[model samples]
Target: MSKISTDPTRRALNGPTMGTRWTALFHVDPAIDTDPVRAALQAAVDEVDAQMSTWKPDSDLMRLNAAPVGVWQTVPMPLLEVLVLGRDIGLASGGAFDMELGDAVAAWGFGSDTADPVQIRAAMGRHRNTAALEIDVAGARVRKTADVALDLNGIAKGYGVDRLADTLVALDLPAGLVGIDGEMRAMGLRPDAAPWSVAVEAPDPARRSPHSVLALHNAAVATSGDYRHWIDVQGCRLSHTMDPARRAPLVAPPASVTVIARTCAEADAWATALMVLGAEAGATLARQIGLDALFLLRDPTMGFRSKAVGRLFCDQCPEAAAQHAQ
Candidate 1:
């Protein structure tokens, strides 16, 4: 007598959310119907977009923005959670990861509307503070002590990925890899009992390619870079990331910064924070906090170089160094 072993079927599901697509890959029994799973995943990301989108005029976040200062506005639980996390990271990063930069984002044409000079001047001249915002977690409400416009562009898509992961767990799926845009999270090992492979994109506006590869198991990764979205002003190309101090795009920043953390949301926000902090200061903070990050620097002589922090990225440093040495 002999025993037989069968491998589960591989399933890849995707749908649109947050101006991009959300993808989920997993292996499941061949007999299982995936329609319900697809529906659940779509619903999860749709809810996130409904609550946090800056482009949506009537989104929950926009409603909060319209509310009078010093008055509490009730928001959805998920939005509240994200606001709290954003505030915490804002304080930790010393305003490098600001959540109150909606005006600047809109002024610079990164939001739903086109850039306006009047609005740009207003955003640049106005003084703002992250401490002005208040969150009542128990009641799921938030308010502004002064005037502040909150934007979750740096974190929303990652949270959308997290919601997809949660939906899979609720659906009783054992293992999966989920992503929205470039942000990704891996729940468990693959059918072959190996970690998921994700690419760290090179900072090149001309083309899309990987700078390095990472093996992710029960973790998440995110990248913030200057090459993707930008605006041209007076012959200068500026990235979408805003400096809280200048209330404008960063003058000079690293080509890209990648971070790996326990959750996709954390990785996304931290990547932005580190990008604003620049390479030297960012690397120091990344090490102090025990975060795994890789900074891709632009070189006048060489094309690009890397400064890696924490244990996870150290192995990849050698290849980058070797290229520069050549």
Candidate 2:
């Protein structure tokens, strides 16, 4: 009988750049070289940062913002796709997730600069431009009747995670988990034949404990919250998530919203939309749209509380089902 060759599997790779860390893990032959895979994954991440980063004035997003209205300015394909998706989601969620909030985000100090009172007022008074904008993806262009600035901060990271995972798979490593910041995508099962486990961080600024853990087989997870990026003005805390209608921070803070979906982009947008909608309406809408989501709210007296929506959490949380029954 011929002896069989058995090879150990390589599982994890990590690199730091783009203001955050990029992590990749796969169950692949350990004997197979992984340096090329690492390099390709990092390159894909760099491409995403270059195209969508608001911190970079020369980024494609900024170029699109500065471009003249009603003109078909050619832009990189990735940016064009993200913008197109933003438009679709904005309309789908009734403008809850607006990409035309660049001015608002920057004015609120969510961008690369400090908060400016003048910009904040202007951003608040500015009319929403997303409702009037149109995108032509096939033509690789966009047009706006009114002055509108685009920001992909909400969806870009998740999209980047998806891009990274796709890059790994294209390089013949189909079983891997790719993550940037907190947004992540799991391509296949781990080497132990178990689903990839990810922790959903608690929204408590004072606590680093994870509130919930998810077992992802082949899916993407994205979380949006008010805890990380915020401003304090006269003892009032303000989050980066702007209400498009008011063009300011959300009046009521939602501790956090975590979404698990088929694609990172969808999960990202859904998380933002839920944040904007607040807990009650957001939960209702999420169920109506059949989204898998977890909404965490901060209590004035109690530290934190949570609610789960959709089928994904049905098996995980019996309380969610019990609450639904009542």
Worst 10 residues of 2 by lDDT: 317-326
Candidate 1 lDDT trough over 10 residues, lowest sum: 317-326
The candidate that achieves the highest lDDT relative to the unseen native structure: 1
TM-score of each predicted structure versus truth: 0.95, 0.92
Best by TM-score: 1
In candidate 2, position 111 carries an lDDT of: 87
Q: Write the per-residue lDDT of candidate 2 for residues 161-277, one digit (tens) a residue.
A: 988899988987777788988898888877677778788888878768777677787889899998987899889998889898999999776888988888898899989999999
Off by over 4 Å in 1: 1-6, 315-326
Q: Please, what are the lDDT tens digits per residue for candidate 1 over residues 1-326? A: 22222458899999999888999999987779999999999999989999999989899999999899999999999999899989999888988999999999999899988999999999999987758888999988989998888899999988899999999989998689999989999888898888888888889999999887888888888999999999999999999999999999998899999888988999999999999999999998998899888899899898998889877877356433211100
lDDT for every model?
0.89, 0.82
Q: Which stretches of candidate 2 lie over 4 Å from their true place?
A: 1-5, 315-326
